[model samples]
Target: MTPFLEFDLRMIIVDRLEKSYGGRTALKGISFRVHRGEVLGLLGPNGAGKTTTMKILTGLIPATGGRASVAGFDVHEQSLEVRRRIGYLPEHPPLYREMTVRGFLRFVAELRGVPRSKRSAKVDRAIEQCGLAEVAGRIVGRLSKGYRQRVGLAQAIVHDPEVLILDEPTVGLDPKQIVDIRSLVKGFGGERTVILSTHILPEVTMTCQRVVIITRGSIVAEDSIANLTGRGEMGERMAITVARDLDGVASTLAGIPGVIGVDRAPGEPPTYHVSVERGFSGKELLSAAVVQSGCGLLEMKTVPETLEDVFLDLITEEHGVAA
Candidate 1:
């Protein structure tokens, strides 16, 4: 008997995209592809062309040169169709202040081409999904920033597009609102392709499936969150507390084949935090060596690499090179 197989489609495709403003290059031939059912994070410091790239992809602005497609439609040729298939949540979401929440969403639903008969149902569904039912009748201008943000999100999803391009979705919201919005974003990860641009590092770590790191208008790294911060890219950090003097530990660990650097941490008994140089498993090697050595290896622990570390490492390297 044969088994059935399913494959996800490609959501966004960009190649050799270039954009310039007043002779200043914003995106220097940037390129990347995002797969369907995955949240791709557009991460970079300020002025790294994240906005430029997003604008080009969403058909908000034309690229100076190169090609892109959204949901199998060419951005240059079939922009309207592309727009219909994608929902864009810009950094500063455009909202009509004078309209009530329900009225605003109904207007947006109509604007996005929802069928006349289904517009009400669509609006109701969007409001419910975005947790806007209580504030549905209130004027948008009177709503809080967090509620307004949800209104922005509601408008974006009113048409039930296949792709969602979110720029700083959690901006200006309280911690609770941020968590709520992030949870909603994560819910769409395996159903629709999400292109999320955010400065919040934890949001990316928590919600995104893949991360694209850009620096100086170019892609410096692109990989899954797990692989990007895994033991290979960032060597494991092992902390060992022992009852001994802090002499020659750095050099001794550095002498080990895969050990990179060892630094003495300030504490009562003294501890050495070691960085594994190569991609070897530090847990087994460190435990075995510590047992064999005469030093009383009181405690040893491994610190997992996080997205924050990866982001810091990338930007620090860029700054170092620039300097």
Candidate 2:
């Protein structure tokens, strides 16, 4: 059967994908899609089937059940075509430590079937984009950890495939290298379909337009960061401060219609965190409720929910345990 996204504009699609090793299942019917030119993140904690999903999409492993396609080519039956269309960077880079940076990229380009006429130009462009020109002549084995990472990135883009899949691209790097690699990853997003598979929350928040959150071999949530932060279970929240800490001040605000919960923060004037249900236009209502209760409304400001909070909340809610 033709997949819905196969005929549409989506760059990749996975439907009911499953994988197992002997008795342990790695992925349990997890599914998601990535649109062309869109950056999507497969986010999860360690051992959450994220890597399994990437391997299947990249044709490095076979899914025991279900269907997955990239660029309208089946991953199982058309792996060669899928590989030709995708440039993947696994968690630990596959590097020939004995080769020079330029030589290694040239070799990768050759392996990926780059035409002899354009191979040098492609290799040079990848080197420049990954900031590896300074070490183009350096041996991969002798380079610093950061430099080796740059080499990894250069090789991934050396082929310039239609889709780019990076699995934990920034792992094992220091803070500065993390920042540098993130900049390169950001640049690659809009030019092609990029799937960033990582466990780090900041990685998704900073670069991805949408996220697929998975845990325990199952997908728990998938949506744009904005939707998850503003409209999800946490809902719309506001930060409020009152001039005086009246005895019934907490109860007064809690009495307001549509107010879900009011929490007090540590401060002189007594600050309150007011959370409301979805579709509740409680800004003016909250202000009026505060004043009518005989308390001074010193301040009121909207506070968008953090991704960390939403991620933890969804995971914990799904599993009925601490995340």
Candidate 3:
């Protein structure tokens, strides 16, 4: 007999979820999902509906149309249950500046409905997990911006919810602080589901397993980072740099097998952007052709599209310009 499976693989689901504020639509039927133990990034510019989507998922705000669910509980119909299964750290975390870190987290634990007996242990675990041991007894207001952010994260996870939603978790901190906070966030994957919403592209590139890009209150793209940046409709892009500036380089590369077109990067002499046809894996052929033509091949590497590239393309196409 086969082994029994008890847990659902998908931890969160948003289906055609829509929201409006007064007369403005904040989300235009956006939809996505987060699987168990996965770190998904929600990326967009300001007023792009990332926070709105997160609000709907966390039961902080109701969606005007469609539906969302967390841990198999409908966000609208089973809000309390949904809230119980998720932890949220908004752009500005709810914190009492006068309270010490330990006291604040203990308060959050009690408010989250942890038993009196288990509250200390829960708070301790959260403090440790968020690297707040040194500042546990320090007043929240007295702590550095980085430590305060950690405290905010501690409070969010104090109850050990199945999912964590972090909005701009590293908005205003020093470079070191950003690195430390990023390390902390990166450690949450594979044990708990996380939905990180931020305007920082490098954060998503370094931390998330997959990404969903929203623009003008709608989802413009969603895919694993590799796929989003690697394979395009035209195929992969190879950046070839030659030591000598050979005339007719563009035509020469375009004639090679699997080569679709070629263009020169701005202000980058002797370096050409070669677009390959779909399903083509002929970087070697392209490189050999360049060398055979007597153009000294300095560097040849596949240039995967960056998240910024993908984001600008989608948002520009959607609104006819950057948002």
Candidate 4:
């Protein structure tokens, strides 16, 4: 097996993928992989080549250079095979406004080459899965934006493709609609590989198993969300509230093995933020040290780093700006 396939049966592969519009390059030799049953978030700012990458992967547009493959078939060489194995929802879903929700889905099923015997079942399944049962009989033009987005999603899945590529799926949704759509996308995990291209950081945190951050037409970082947010690092900061002398508590915590330093939190009485050294996983030792020093441990919790922090730091670094 090739090295890439040896890794984990990659469902999608982009090898030095590049795209250009006239003289301007939209993708600068980017490369990544999406493994079976994994939700990989493609995050980037506006005009950052995110949409371009999605288009290339979905075979909506041909790449200027390099190669891509879906389900082991070349996207450009075996386009039909690739399309048959993948479902695509563009940023603007191509919906026939005059068609009823059920009608649109049935049309999509036929376009996707679903067998006549299975078309009805497939259309029904898509409508139910996307929560469009109530709106199923309504005209597409009369439905709300959220329901329209659901119809788009239903059509994409009508053929039951193995890979689902959604571009800004919840772009125009309300808060509740966004939440509902997120739940639906999360449900696709472990059954279908998904490439979710969006600018919403929280959506990635809630739905994606791994993230690929691109900037200025190139990939800047690719890793699991935890690792990207520094959660995987051995060095950690934990907040602890104790009912004792702040000086004594700080001193005691600093003395614990692996406890590097302790500082009083600004304007917070009896609470100290403890910094643990790298390679240390000694929360228990710190707790024991606190109690032994006559400091009552009221509460102790680790401070988690957010994805927004990571995203900004990376984007800043890519632009050579001091963060």
Candidate 5:
């Protein structure tokens, strides 16, 4: 596919973005893109330039250097147009305590340029879409945290913007509320593009199609969730419980052509979690080695690869290199 179609005219594009606070740099020339119709997870630990990038993308702040464009408009030159095409939910949901959910939504629609005739209909749609119907008449300030968050989401989408930028969308939420918010985000599916920033790895796995991991104010890795997690041939990990001794088990497995590393889990009759190198299938070799060693393989199955592993590995490996 052409680059335009591949990235859908670049829903979010940042080239060598740089920012500094006083003399200390907060961003060191970071750059990445979010494609249309895809939920791209922007992941990093605290101080990783995630929020800084989001702020720049949403026109909250100006970049010290480099270029940015969202929804086909240059962020610097076309800030207003860019804002008009995007929806944003900052870490702190902007809300008015005295305004009911319905009132706040109508105000947001109007601010987004919705016509008077269509404002009510738009507000109603957003309320329903975000599951705010039951709480629509309640004052936003008096609503539960989850309901308030839902109202924030509703306001972001009230104008039907082409792109949605959410920072820490699931932060400070209970398990049930997190699930609800993720479900609401998933409902955005193909109709709008999503650029979500969060430290939560599982959230990225559940809601995002691709991931862009940043660290030290720089882009570290970017790829589809499948590629990042080794859903392809490379990402398979196995946990082996052997009835044999733990001694040298890690080394023996490490010697296998496809085995990456073997770490002993803390316990008796030690079990080891083995990660296979990318593009290597070590299952058969593992079985053979267990059989040859006269060790009974207690259990072995394909465990789903986690974004946490990839995130930690990348960040740790980067630090190791810098050190």
Candidate 6:
């Protein structure tokens, strides 16, 4: 049975987590939580502690300090219990290339503690769930990279664990393969708690409900995709086209209250990009301004802020580093 979609019930928790190697500090007291039956993306640039956090959570390595738990079991103190409740897919698929797809899944199911009598049914469910039924008999080494990823995912889910941790699940996939895997992962909501770690921005937008952005071994931002992109101080952007192409058109639009900045692109029908306060209504004000200014408003459209834009803005704001 799947867990009901409950925000109050947290499935994973990390508190004041720190990690180090030799003289390098990898993670600096990062903290976050994943709700039960939700998809959370741990996003960051390469070497930004995304994988390091995943490794620690999956009990693959020891954390220098702090605490982490999955399904209420401490990752370090209750390693075996934690592992039993979670399915982990690292950056690289740990597939026995020599074994057939079906064989590899059976092996993984057995290793994951599925009883002998239940192994076959569990394996069959995983195969069908991951769209691997067609290639179940093919040798894993002979299958394409896309198929290999499917096998890896199927193996992770064979035991039907409550938590699924995926590190760069679509790292080496082609466009179609990426889309296919995204569709598969997107279907997992409400049935499992998923932590999808990746540097790819679209992956988070397409598959996750919330995100934890890490940079230089620290947590910079954590919130729902809507709140992160919608509540920024950057405000709403607009593109206003003027048919008259009059001088001072930029100034005219800029004079409107709440319109912060305006610039005209070079052309006959000049297009002015206008920046306004986040909650301001721009259409009527802009239309009236352009009409009064005699610039002859042709068209005005809102420019939306995407997750990528928000990510870049956050990275630049947090570290003052250009993206």
lDDT of 5 by residue, 255-321 (tens): 9987767778788675788878656666788878876766677877666777787788889978897
Scored by TM-score, the top model is 2
User: Model 3 — which ten-residue stretch has the worst lDDT?
Assistant: 1-10
List model 3 lDDT by residue over 1-323, tens digit each. Answer: 11122247888888999899999999999889899999999999999999989898888899999998888888888888878778899989889999999999999999888999999999999999888998899999998888888888998899998899999999998988888888888899998999999988999998999999998888888999998887585577788888887788788788877888898886655789888877777777787888888878999888777778888878888887544
RMSD of 1: 4.5
Lowest lDDT 10-residue stretch of candidate 1 = 1-10
**TM-score versus the correct structure, for each prediction:** 0.91, 0.91, 0.89, 0.80, 0.89, 0.90
lDDT of 5: 0.84
Worst ten in a row by lDDT for model 6: 1-10
Report the candidate with higher TM-score, 1 versus 5: 1
How many pairs of residues collide in each model?
1, 0, 0, 0, 1, 0
lDDT string, candidate 1, 1-323, tens digits: 11111223777888888888888888888788899888999998878888888888789999988888887777878788788888888888789999999999999989999999999999999999999999999999999999999999999888888899998899899999999999999998788889998777888898898899887777878899988888356578888888776456556666777787788888768788888854566567677666566567899987787888888888888779879
Residue 73 Cα positional deviation in candidate 6, in Å, after optimal superposition? 1.0
Which tens-of-lDDT digit does each residue in 1-323 have in candidate 2?
45334366788998999999899999999989899988998899899999999999998899999999998889988888889889988889889999999999999999999999999999999998999889999899999988887888888889998899999999989999999998888888788899998889999988899999999899988999888776658677888998888787788788888889989988788899988887778789789888887778899998878888888987887778533
Question: Judged by TM-score relative to the true structure, which candidate is superior, 1 or 3?
Answer: 1
Error of 4 at 87 (Å): 0.8
lDDT of 3: 0.87
lDDT of 6 by residue, 135-170 (tens): 999999999998999898998899999999999999
What residue runs in model 3 are displaced by over 4 Å at the alpha carbon?
1-7, 255-257, 281-296, 321-323
- Worst window of 10 by summed lDDT in candidate 5: 1-10
